[model samples]
Target: MKLSEGVEAAIHCATLLAQLEEGRTMPASALAEYHGLSPSYLLKHLKTLTAARILESVSGPHGGYRLARSADAITLLDVVLAIEGPQPAFRCAEIRQRGPGALEPEVYAAPCNINAAMLRAEQAYRAELRKTRLSDVISDYLGEADPRALAFSCAFVARNQRPQG
Candidate 1:
């Protein structure tokens, strides 16, 4: 199943936020600039995270946003739900009884096997996402990324970030 664009933006944003030290924050505009995104568009997804309690929002000159909890406490599934809502990706339209040669009520009364299979796949996908924490993803990425580049990125973030107050 395909995830929404908001889901992708939210994941990357969370990963950046996950890199910050405890009690630190980055403004939405700063984050948008860092990723070469539009602040207005990115802020919409940021609000989704805030509404989901994955991140917290602050206002003022030095105000911004920070994780509500540790990175290890948040999972990809949490972000997915926050952006995509609780609807299943594969929606079954119950086509079994709508064809020219339609089946009887009893023949299609039981849950459709195709629908059940899709639901099962969705469950497995969610289970995998739940098993993965945001910190785990960051650690894995840092492990494979260029050390010098990673250092430079961290330095950039450190320079622009604000300490939580």
Candidate 2:
């Protein structure tokens, strides 16, 4: 199951927002620039997050966007759903109902093994993702990097961030 690029972008953008001080805002352009993404596209992703209430936008000279809740409170699934909607990745077209050798009405009522297997896989994927929060991802990333390097990266993002007009 392939997820959209917006899913990745939204997750990264939310993770970065989680790093900022509470009440601090970061512009969409800043987020896009930091990740080398297109600002227009990133803004579209940001709107999804906002619509999900995972992030909130503030308007004004110094206003931009900030996480609506704590990082630990947001799950990977939350970010994913925000950008990609709540639709399941695997869609069953019920191929068994069609084709030359279609089953009879009584037999066709039963669930196919393929559908069951896909359902199981999707459940497992969601379970794993639900186990991981945005906080966990950030902690894991920071744990592997040097303090100086981490600081430098943060500083670079801060320096390069363009405040919204």
Candidate 3:
């Protein structure tokens, strides 16, 4: 199943926020420009993150957005659910209950095995996602990059960030 771009954007945004020092903030416009995304759309995703309490928005000349909690406290699943909502990717409509040659009472009364299997698989997928936190992913990203490259990238993001109102 394909996930929405908002999911990816929100995760990236959260990662960026995680990189900031405690009192520092990153504007949504900067995040959009860094990733070549639309500022308006990115703002929407940011709002979702704010509502999820993963990020908090600050107001005034020097205000922007900052992580509400430690990076380790936020999970990939949290960012995903913030943007996509907490709905299952797979849904069972109980197709066996429909059609002229539908299943008999004994069959219809029991939950479809197909639905059960799908649910199990979906649960496993969510469980794996839940195991991943923003800190874990960011640490992996930093570990894979050369020290100089990582420093340059961080500086680039910092330089491009705009002051928020």
Candidate 4:
């Protein structure tokens, strides 16, 4: 199942926010710049993340966003649902009930096997996402990313994050 581009943006921005110390935040513009995304485009997803309580919005000159909770507490599934909504990726249209060979509604009263299988797959997908936390993501990135790339990212965050009152 395909997910929206916003999901990637949200997760990346959230991971950046996780790098901040307590009471610090990064502006949406900085986040957008870091990812080479349009500020408005990234802001839209950031707002959705705010609404989901995965991130908190702080307004004013020194305001931007911070994680609503610690990085370890926010799962990849949380960012995904905040951007993609809670709907299952595969929706069953029940096409099995239509066509010349279609049986009576009563005959098809049992749930379709295809639909059930899709639902099971979706459950497994979501479970995997739920197992991943932002902290885990950061740890993996830090462990595997090139030293120069990691240094650049750390410097950018250092320059952009603002401390809150």
Candidate 5:
């Protein structure tokens, strides 16, 4: 299933926000700059995340976005759903029922095997995402990232993050 680029941006932004100190926030522009994404495009996903309570939007000068709850409390699934909506990636059109030599509706009472299989796969995919918390992602990244890259991230966060009053 093809997902939107927004999903990657939102998750990465959320993970980056996890690096912020409590009571601090990172602006959408900063997040876009870090990932080389368009602020306008990233802001749309950020707004959706805020609406989903995965992230909070603070207003005024020195205002920006922060996780609404702890990173451990937010799963990748939450961010994904917030950006992509709760709809399954594969929508079953039941094309099998519309082709020539199609049987009566009663004959197809049971779901199409292909649709059921795809749905099952999607369920497994979502379950895996649900198992992954933002904290886990950040921790894993920190453990394996190159030193220079880590230092750069730390420096950027220090420079761009704002303190909330």
Candidate 6:
């Protein structure tokens, strides 16, 4: 299953927001700048997350965005589903039931094996994502990242992420 660029951006931005102090918010422009993404495009995906209740959008001066719930409460699957929608990646078009090689109608008593296998794989993929959360990923990253660099990033975001004036 190929993930859209929006999914990747949403995940990264959400995890970054998870780094902020409670009640703090980062404007979409700041987040887009941080990741070198287009604010307009990124906001499209962010709206999906907000609509899913995974993130909150604050309005007015100093308005921006923050997690609607704890990072651990939000899984990678949450963000993925928000941005990618609930449609299964591999839809069973029943190709086996069509074309010149199509089997007799009565011969199709069993479920399509290929469809079953693909569905199983998709389940496994989603399960893995659901098992991981933004906080978990951040913790894992902190372990492998340079302490000074992480500190600098945190400080930078905190300093530059003031609610819009």
Candidate 4, residues 10-38, lDDT tens digits: the string is 99999888888889999999999999999
Q: Model 3, poorest ten-residue lDDT window?
A: 156-165
List model 3 lDDT by residue over 19-53, tens digit each. 77657787778888878999999998888789889
- Candidate 6 lDDT over residue span 51-140, tens digit each: 999999988777899999999899999999998899889998777889998889888888989989998999999999999988899899
TM-score each candidate. 0.94, 0.90, 0.89, 0.97, 0.96, 0.93
lDDT (C-alpha) at residue 11 in model 1? 85
Candidate no. 6 TM-score: 0.93
Predict model 2's lDDT versus the native.
0.84
The candidate that achieves the highest TM-score relative to the unseen native structure: 4
Candidate with the larger lDDT of 1 and 3: 1
Residue 61 local lDDT, model 5? 93
Where does candidate 4 clash, by residue pair? Answer: none
Model 5 stretches astray by more than 4 angstroms: none
Q: Would you list the clashing residue pairs of candidate 3?
A: none
Q: Rate the local accuracy (lDDT) of all candidates.
A: 0.89, 0.84, 0.82, 0.92, 0.92, 0.88
Displacement of residue 51 (Cα, Å) in model 4 is 0.6
Once fitted onto the true fold, the runs of candidate 3 whose alpha carbons sit more than 4 angstroms away are: 103-106, 146-149, 160-165
lDDT of 1 by residue, 61-151 (tens): 7689888888899999999999999898999999878979897888887899999999999999999999999999989988899989798
Per-residue lDDT over 65-100 for candidate 2, one digit per residue giving the tens place of the 0 to 100 score: 888999999999898877877878888898888889
Clashes of each: 0, 0, 0, 0, 0, 0
